[model samples]
Target chain A: MKKFLGAELFFESLYDLGIRTIFGLPGGYVLKIYDVMPSYSKKINHVLTRHEQAATHMADGFSRASGLPGIILCTSGPAATNTITGITTAYSDSVPVLVFTGQVPTPFLGSDAFQEADHIGITRSCTKHNTLVRKTVDLPKAIAEALFISNTGKKGPVLVDMPKDVLISESEYKMPKEVKIKSYSPKVPLKNSEYESFRKVLTASKRPLLIFGKGACSDFNKKLISKFLNKSKLPAMSSIMSLGLIDGTNKFNFGVVGEGGSAVSEDLINKADLIVSVGCDLIKIVPESNLKSKDIVVVNIDKANFNARTKGNMNIHTDSDNFIEKLSAEKGLSFEWEADNLQKLREKYLNSQEKEAKTNKRAGIFKLISNLSPKNSVFCSDFSYEDVILQKFLSVSDFKDSILSGGNGTPGYGFPAAIGATFARPKSKVISISSGINFQFNMQELIVTLEQKIDLTIVVLNEKKNKQKKYSGPDYKSLGESFGVKSHQLSYNDKNFENNFKKFFNHKGTALIEILI
Target chain B: MRHIISILVDNEPGVLARIAGLFTARGFNIESLCVAETEKPSLSRLTLVTSGDEWIIDQIVKRFENMINVIKVEDLSGEDSLERELIIARISTNQKTRSEVLRVADIFRANVVDVGPKSYALELTGNKEKLEAFIEILRPLGLKEISRTGLISLKREKKKITER
Candidate 1:
């Protein structure tokens, strides 16, 4: 008979799943698991984060970069609660993360046991799925299921709450050979009627616009999207989260569309007769209010968004790539009207090329990024006017990777996520386009990047004052003060910040570059 | 249009709540709903009859499909399918109603699975219409209380796979 502790089994399963790192803080309830962590240190790296919130963010960053489910572990009670924000962040962003938390012993559960919190109940809303291990025998299966849930379909975070007693309990555990969740099958093949209807709609429409959302940016479907964009010559704009899905240089590209959208891109979206939203939520930011046009077609993996938003239009529920492929295969489609509009857009928006004009730090930073970015570099940007400025100055080639925060516009997300991206694709150069103030939120994360020897570059826009206040005046400063920023205290001089950053990173075995204008 | 949709979901807590919330948040009307565990312990099947327009139904299906626990969804309105049968027996009989009930049971092909000195039980399996018709007759003949296994379905001939 083979006997093994449940914590060992859980870690073994994680190791088998190719998990290389775990971000977490230790606690009394999870001490046993932490004790066994050293035995597997050679195989897995544990990141001791200052806060559980940061741990979850670290995991999220890892997931965004690697496309693998990010793993996180923490103790019970407040420790577990701290991870809620991170889990919610991952959930909203559709990042795959597996979160593990300790619990008081099952016997002591619901009795106000020390460090006991309703981990499952609290995290249920934030996670795609959650499970509590009641039996020691269920440990392996539960962990496996958590991983499966985190990685499958519209991937998001999943939580497994392990009771301390269950962790210490001995049982003959056999990992489930397969998972058969009958009620939850996510595969939906397009119906024949749906296909015909979509084909007819596509053929009849004179002016068609493609709006790619984050779901279309999956690694599995990039080629299909590229092929479709190449063939259709339809002007397309990605959601902020879907930034790099379509190459900026593509003839049909209209750039990102929203509040921070380019003037030309917004103009094209407003003029589109038939708007095709692929895997986008059709939310307020990408406002339907602006789309008074009735002829909108939404193609999405989620039927609810499509159906809800399909009042005066056609809604197609299918995988983004599959729908694009099906559309590409249809015969007798002429887009003469679309071609005319594309040319008009090109003449209006594409004609302005100002590489020689460097008037401000925003423009300078943008030019620097465009000039120095390697063929396959990944750019992560903070939510600043710099994003808009960079859009104007930098022309992303077909090969570079661009990751944006999208719906979850959390500040300080860029630097850590960039670090995770570097870890995910070590061969690719990873850079963060940071706003000066947003950098203050997760400054501690830079220590992790340095310690891990991750190759990531942080390009901070060193504006001595809040430009929004400087330009928009006292009103903006009032709002900034209300939001907890002391506008008066915001100032910086040219003080060899690059070398200082390099020295800080040098101790941790990483590289840093700071550009001051 | 009110369409009958069958959904397969993981047998976990809060899944039903999430599904219901999704529908309610959209202000869609769910006329009737039935959910229960199937042969598989870890999976549950939900049958919902909803009245909405084409766009609304499409949205409901699309949103439901996006949920991680939802394995599959089927709209049976346009298919050849077999609906499930639920039977309940309420008898008030010492000897007189017993024979009458037995004669009726024999005629309707229902089985008397339970029996007591004053009461007897009969099990019937059929479509909702047939079951309702039988219940109407039983009601007048002193039917007691009834239990029903809502609606379960399988395609009549071949399995039709619908894609998203």
Candidate 2:
């Protein structure tokens, strides 16, 4: 054990857990932690953001892109309150994030001291778990427990509220070998009887549809899921969060199937005899009326995701990979779907999309971006009409290739998430697509691109005129220039529009291309 | 249906609020609640009474099990369980009405804990129906005030199994 201050212990604990980066802005209660940040700078990289909300989103984006828990640190009161939206976003999407907020001294707690807030009380419902560190000795254990809780089970945001006095005090700290929380165990072992029942259900159904959600994205065995679907010859659909899990071009895969999804997939939801939803929450996506008549077999470890809102046929209490592996091993399991019918639906969907691209300029812009950007590019969009258009056109081949504020549908999620995604996937191109009003949510973050010299492309579809009567937004060209980044403006009918966009796309550094229609 | 949900949780601050907040947020009502330290000093047992349909009760149970501090949750609704509540009632009695109050207290097997010239404070422990009956019978005897501890329940186990 080593005697170290609470601030040092906090950094050391995170370093031991393989956390190399954090995003946040320091303030009054958190200044002491920042003062000692340089000592650990060689080991841990800290990204200073303009706002606490952006810092939270950056961490969330990092997690969604890399499958690593995003970590954020900030001060108490308003700073802590600011992270709530970002925290709720991660919570709704089942993305793991660790949020550390500095609080007032223990003596001043509940006295309405300056810069003090009840962080735990405010974040209780939103977080997977949250705690306030009252004593210096418990700081290390609290961080370990918070990390364990956030990264395991349903995987959402966890907060650790650190009182200022605790940060100033010193304690003999030892790294915990393992964290054991008796109350939480995400694993539900599959029984042989369960497999038998699942096989029976599969054998009885003729046209079974497979639906994927964010819960299935963590399997990392993307090929296994693909192979199972191909061998079984079952049609499949994806939720907004699981946009890229199944290849969009696959004959059996009918793109996304929710409010932001395609029309063909929604119609298919009504046609299927049975739904084998793997790691997806059907209650949020499918209407209760549609789900009532159909047989649903939900495969998810969390009991909370089961169909409490409607009647469910069966629940396989296990992870997607476990259930998929078992199902793939079954013999003589075949689906009775007509290939001709599926082909007709696929062709009709593609035809409608092509017609949309020809008619709608916004749809055309998305088509252009999808056609021009590298196949491995990561696209992040704010929750807006522009995101819906992007989702319809973008064919994602990689897991989480298309990111959005899916569960919470937060407006200003695109730009900051793009910044975080850039850091997470440095080898791949990262693009942030947003409309005029949505981009203004976190527009101040434009300086981050210039400051970090990040390689990212900002695509703004200028549709502010639609909301001009409500509010007038700033000029994107001037905003980009003031941030010292290359900026370009183009209209849909401009001469050599594609060529201008191509030049900006391959600009070799941070740049903005505002497309006006 | 009324459900007696007994929860075993780590004895820590803010834990009670976390468990209760789930019900409040979901628009579920808690009829009564009792909390005390368990035999294991590190844990606390909270017995809560609530009424809802089967589906709603199942959802509530799953949510309670999901909390980080909750070690275990059991719905004692269908189990062989014993429930009890303690109540203290104070009644004003004059010289003419003292015998009537004493007779009512005797019939309910209540112990007189405090006595004054014009008042008698009686304490009784029983199930919901018994307690309610005793209160109803004492109301006409110049009942002054009443305080009750919420229901606390435990499941029954075979005595031989533990002895072995």
Best candidate, TM-score? 2
* CA lDDT for candidate 2: 0.85
The per-residue C-alpha lDDT of model 1 at residue A345 equals 75
Interface RMSD after interface superposition, each candidate? 4.0, 4.2
**Top model number, DockQ:** 2
Q: Please state every model's RMSD to the true fold in angstroms.
A: 7.4, 2.5
Tens digits of per-residue lDDT for model 2, B1-164: 99999888889998999988988887989999999988878889999999987887888788887888888888988888889999999999999989998898899999999999989999999999999999999988898999999899888873111100
DockQ comparisons of all candidates to the true complex = 0.34, 0.51
Local accuracy by lDDT, each model = 0.71, 0.85
| Candidate 1 lDDT for residue A141 | 82
> For residues B83-135, what per-residue lDDT tens digits would candidate 1 score against the true structure?
77678787777666678888888888899989888787889999778888888
Residue runs of model 1 more than 4 Å from their true location after superposition: A307-310, A330-332, A338-341, A351-360, A384-400, A462-517, B1-164
Candidate 1 residue A178 Cα shift, in angstroms, is: 3.3
**Model 2 regions more than 4 Å off:** A464-471, B158-164
